[model samples]
Target: MNRDRSLRYRLAGIEIFAILLALLFLAPFYFVLVNSLKTLGEILVDAASLPEAYKFTNYSRVWDMIRFPTALRNSIVITAISVAGIVTISSMTAYRLVRRPTRFNNLLFLAFISSMIIPFQSVMLQLVRVTSILELRGDLLGIVVCYLGFGLALSVFLFHGFIKGVPLEIEEAAVMDGCSPYGVFWRIVFPLLKPIAVTVVILNTLWIWNDYLLPVLIIGSNKDLTTIPLAVTRFFGQYTKQWDLALAGLAMSVTPIVVLFLLLQKHIVEGIASGSVKG
Candidate 1:
């Protein structure tokens, strides 16, 4: 009886510790949200207090100043295209490499994996110069290509791991049934890779959508083509800053990602966990 009571106590203690850790992680978000509703004066005076009066005007002003609708559209288009390209190319490449497992395939896979370790800063200057020479600077298409190149390594790495766990016999059976290589992949292998695909889509979507550095480097002078991150940056100047509007703009920027994660949270978690296990 005493041993069972001790086990119960230990379990209760663990539950309490987990609850505390969860609250600790959530505190910063609570701070951001509550302060977003407060006036500038209230935030400065007592950030912990609930807003004396909720100011919906901050969001409205931010929306107009940041051109939220336009920025949102640009981000969506860029994210969608970049993610689609990454998933399609990476999935096929990984599937082939895993199925064949030749020495050359292994070498190519290592090369792709090695690219991830090379820091972006090391190549930033050269990338800018090359893009300028190619006349790709300040173009959305240029930025999209850059995103694809940088994002491909990680996507391929993830897909390679997941593909290894998939059974070879399935593809063989499809081949014997007279399915073309393309048909075998599309009709057989691709559907089985749905989990990893969702994982890749979610990760790349978030990264590309929120990316500030690559877009800034590749895109210049084109206000119409500016992404949300670049547009929000306009609020911060060397001599002056629009703190209220900036925070509001950030909140607006974060809403879509938050909503997306909430909607796809289950799939994202399952996909990543299963992919990791298989990889």
Candidate 2:
């Protein structure tokens, strides 16, 4: 039928546009990967062209130079702990804020939402002072704590809106079935939060894994606690620009994030679609 053909045409156009957009976003990665294999001389000459010989040695050199294994372990540890903490605490906090709706809860919710507007720079000094007082500086635990603080606001806000959309009747039914508060949340509510949880995981993982500023301010002296971003930064110096190592290190650093994003991208889209349907 004509209508079917028209629908097909529209879908085709949308797919084409979406693919174009995806390629546009991936352009930077292509540039980085290509240049990563090239020598500094080759990069300087023509970054776009393929290397005459793929110097995978750049990867090996950068790996050793930046203590890549240690950095990776630290990044994974920090990101995992920070993300898990954010998801657990924010989910509970948001659920309480929605279900309770007390004046104090409302005020607290407003505070979390409002905190998002404050730039990190404006509060950086005060944050340092607070961390020092709490003796949470110059340690891995300290940096993770910092991430939890900075990551909580946006995450709690997101969970607040999402939890509000989750039907109350389901929770009420769970309560009636002799489910305790914690049991109901863990058994019924939390399981239903898979979609939004994916979003939370991806967002927090990327931010915490790549974050350099907070780590520098908090635990920069602890070389053992340095993250991928910090390691890559220390790889570069003032007078001597090791473009070969820098480019290779950048490629290595971004690879995990790119892989994670791609792996979880489908879940994120599904989350959005499910949220729309629920709304």
lDDT of 1 by residue, 1-279 (tens): 999999999999999999999999998777777777777777788867777878878889879887899889888888888889889988988888888889999999999988878998998899999999998888778888888888888888888887788898998998999999999999999999887888889878878988988888888578777788888787664214455566677888888988988998998788667656754
Error of 1 at 198 (Å): 1.9
Report the Cα lDDT for candidate 2: 0.86
Q: Cα miss at 100, model 2 (Å)?
A: 1.4
- Candidate 2 per-residue lDDT, tens place, 123-182, comes to 888999999999999997888788888888877887888888899999899889989999
Top candidate on lDDT is: 2
Q: List pairs with backbone clashes in candidate 2.
A: none
Give the runs in model 2 whose Cα sits over 4 Å from its true position. Answer: 1-27, 269-279
Question: Can you give the TM-score per candidate against the true fold?
Answer: 0.88, 0.85
Give the range where candidate 2 is weakest over 10 consecutive residues by summed lDDT: 270-279
Residue pairs that clash (backbone atoms under 3 angstroms), model 1: none
